[model samples]
Target: MSNLNKLDFSALEVFGRNYLKWVQDVKLHLIVKNLHPAIEDKMDNLVGEAKKANAMIFIRRHIHDALQTEYLANEDPRALWVALVDRFDHQKDIFLLEARHDWQYLCFQDVKSVNEYNSKVC
Candidate 1:
């Protein structure tokens, strides 16, 4: 895995574009690897920050072929907003619609494919 700072932004942009396509296509079990530790740490920080802001966080992990893998994937905006409105929803740290849009914007500026975006962001 390359250092997070060494990630290729151009590849990330392409990845984001393709990711949306994959989501629309409902391709499950997307595989992304070779992530920098720093990136993972940042994700942890982001989740903590969101929690502090009264947001819920949902972490999903996959264990297949004796391997454990994790990544931040798409979120349901409407559900997130409803949770926010309740102010008691447990799934608050997951990015809401607005946050997701912002993230997508940033990702689109960096990655080139869904796989590449997942790798760079993760």
Candidate 2:
């Protein structure tokens, strides 16, 4: 395998570390209790090499998702909000506004607020 492939494994480790941090920060005791032991061990092993890679992966994924929404908005101006909401379904509430002639801007809200906003908009 190439060096890049080997390095990619580091991202897994970072994901594990971040998952752990999230669990602690959020005090997700139930989630931690339910997580598989084997998976936990694997994440521990990958922690050292994966931190930076994991963050990069996360940012890239979000950017990619946003760009995809932008593309969809370009294809259909009226459908931009639909595309943003679809992309962030089950997690975040997205609001889309036309920023310019063909560009759209996205704003995120909490799920409850988003639902209320969606009801008003729709």
Candidate 3:
């Protein structure tokens, strides 16, 4: 892990999913959640450590800038995660629109056979 380069999280599905799984594996997911005060007090140091680690993982300049202004300002890893989700969730919407357009523009001449075209259109 020490030899691994900084993570590139673009709020895209693959990157986001991998980053989340990494957080879970590192046992830092709790720092991002709303917990009781007693537990929160005990985990304060761990939370800071996780935040630092999370910051280091964001290699993108723009993302790091956002982290400085938004995530770090909030002093909570959860805020960063949520912000990334909110920003990237739009990518899913875009994909849906593109898929709809492709389906709407499907051409019979593009396919080799009627059966294939029928399956595609279906």
| Number of the top lDDT candidate | 3
Q: List ranges where model 1 is wrong by over 4 Å.
A: 1-96
Worst 10 residues of 2 by lDDT: 7-16
Candidate 2 local lDDT, residue 15 = 19
Q: TM-score of each candidate? A: 0.19, 0.18, 0.39
lDDT of each: 0.32, 0.33, 0.46
Task: Report the number of clashing residue pairs per model.
Answer: 21, 3, 0
Q: What does candidate 3's lDDT look like per residue over 1-122, in tens digits?
A: 85364433233233343444343432342333322121232435454455444443442222435345545554444454455556554656666798888875677558988899889878
lDDT of 3: 0.46
Model 1: lDDT equals 0.32
Give per-residue CA lDDT, model 1, range 53-96, as digits (tens): 22112111211111112122224322332322344232234436
Q: 7, model 3: CA deviation in Å? A: 7.1
Which stretches in model 3 have alpha-carbon errors above 4 Å? 1-67, 70-72, 103-106, 109-122
Candidate with better lDDT, 1 vs 2: 2
With candidate 1 superimposed using the best TM-score fit, by how many Å does residue 16's alpha carbon deviate from the native? 34
Prediction 2 TM-score vs. true: 0.18
1-122 per-residue lDDT for model 2 (tens digits): 46443321122122132332332432233234332221232434433234333332332232334354444424322233234334444232211222342241233343357777678667
